[model samples]
Target: MHSGMTDVTFQLRYGSNLTYECSLAADRVVASHLPPPALTDLPARLSEALAAPLEFPALHQAIVPGDNVTIVLERDTPQAGALLAAVWKEIASRGVAPDHLTVLQPASYRSQPPTDPRDALPADVREHVTWKVHEPATEVECAYLASTAAGERIYLAREAVEADFVLTVGELAFDTLLGYRGTSSSLYPGLSTAEALRRSHGQGHDELSPDDQRPLRELTDEIHWLLGGQFSLQVIAADGQNVSAVVAGQADAVLRHGKKLLAETWRFEVPARPELVLVAVEADAGGHHWSQVAAALDAARHIVARDGRIVLLSELEEEATDGILMIRDARTPRDALQPLRQAAPADLIAATQLARTIDWANVYLLSRQDHDLVEDLFMIPLEDENEVDRILDGDEPCAVIGGGQHTLTHLQNR
Candidate 1:
């Protein structure tokens, strides 16, 4: 789109305020996707969004006195403590006793000690709010919900099942399994029984496009509807540590608005398929990891030419997950993925997407990981920007994707 310029400069980011820059011939650049500016006053916007929700009553009006409310909190959400504090303060102000309000944490956080969102609240408010982590394996912690039309039995976290009102606070972003993740995405496998979790997420090859109708997503929606409480609050991420917008309303309405806002904020369309794609991944709170890299590669693979090159740029330092390790130790990707089809581990989806992408295209990595580890995973290790510059110097069309983990990039025709 640069009519006159011969080259365009790109400043890729990772970690807080860290950046890497390179220039490409203007004609060679086919697409560039970047996150929108972060919201300046999140608290004020949150207050306003909660006050006037879409297709639903205000949060305060929806609750009555003596109601036992459960707030399902997404632990990784940006400024989660503040979001939880705001929601809890509103519920408390409406005469709901602190003891009657429960904060239900996801099961994935059980391995590590998670920070208490109550810490962000005022001293008096923080003292009385009850918090419980979801235990899917314990029969006492889960209660029978309804069976699906397909005869699948469902069990939800006892806290949500027993609560008079349920409020889900989560983020809206692209998912490897579900097209768009938010709303009830956290409730199904997140708060359900271990069997349900495995059944829902154990698929190794059920990747869905953002616009496709995914059975997993449909099932999650059914769970949300069956659970009864409709109030939902979802945030659209702006970058690593900030959100661009917060949508609160009926579950369906909030999901619709959130999806629309997400596309407007993160979608990028290229005129045609490109031969080279450079993706930058990062998270400010904790360093980067493999899941983010996998998501970025998935997005890149969508609009990349056959046998194209995808270079993942990050400062990733975490050790590879069990699924990734399985890939490294196996003779072939299919051989490694066979076990995941039966038992979905924490990084199953990420590992599957990564292995598939490695098969589809050439994947290069620039991270803190050891060169041997990167090679074992079948990715070329990128030494420096000089290497990236050398690749860009080639005469093929290329693309740049920022916040690639959160971005959704595709061709205009497809």
Candidate 2:
């Protein structure tokens, strides 16, 4: 139980089955249910999926055997290597020469920085497959038309769009943009020129109302339409540990399958009534944005009690969430409103959606950096480990849920 109005603990649990103790406070709970582990037998699965003889004569004949095929892969994620390897094997067996294959990654965004070289592709595939990286255009300008009427002008990597056949592989996760990311993403945001993407992506940061479709679904659809049927997509949905439950082929089929799977895997059960609840953000998963932290918070709120306390754990790498400037300026929702209103209307809209999703009174964050920033922006205190420990040592009937380091173990002990 919370000793004071502001006091709470963070606990972690996994899949509603296993519980663990974490360094967080006793009243706070964290859920650490990682996506299912990567599917080790992916290659075999891909082989089985492709075993049927080719129906189209055009697909049967390779232009230059195995060496000339072009395969585009998404960046990040531990499963990338396995996914690519499976594609490679499938193509090679179909008579595409190994030397002909080229793997392409989507252009980097300003908000999402590049991955470390160490975490990049393995040497064998790196040596054989040509690599191309695209960055946003420096000189591009953003035009804000309306709530959902922003446009982007990006420079797409020519090789990616020019390929006779482009295969995009990735896991489908809920996104503020395009509803989901996979086939549609690979085409517009993935392969578009930097200028196009910049013009298009700029509006996502604008401030507007929830009813307005400006930054979210509308823009994603616009980008999707612009791709013009240049590439095919393969999307997979994984459990807590990234295990594939559904594999979809073709653009439409893949997207549909991914959406269904997302609905199934992303759901959490909530209690009808409870006095308190705790939530924490995983350092490894959350991308350091308060918005990213908000994603976890949104998941936790679904199951939290009406008057529950939700504590969020985040290592503040940057002041703003999702690279938007206004979010960094204010710590609490009330404090954020002025800056948000002062910003461009589009910016205000995006910020507003974030504000609506989070419960200002119930949220808290524990972080090493910018504790004051979080407090000022979200109205949530930044608590030290000592404070959390003190609360945990006290007597309170607390139920913890959500994810954080050692959170599961802590909950079990409680």
Which is the leading candidate under TM-score? Answer: 1
- Predict model 2's lDDT versus the native: 0.47
TM-score against native, each model: 0.93, 0.65
RMSD after CA superposition, every candidate: 2.3, 8.4
lDDT of candidate 2 over 132-191, digit per residue (tens): 555435323222222323434433555544555555555566544444555556545545
Q: Give the total clashing residue pairs for model 2.
A: 74
Residue 35, candidate 2: how far off, in angstroms? 5.0
Superposition error at 293 for model 2 (Å): 1.6
lDDT score for candidate 1 against the true structure? 0.81
Clashing pairs in 1: none
* Model 1: lDDT of residue 123: 83
lDDT of 1 by residue, 358-380 (tens): 87788888888899998998889
Q: For residue 198, give model 2's deviation from the true position in Å.
A: 3.7
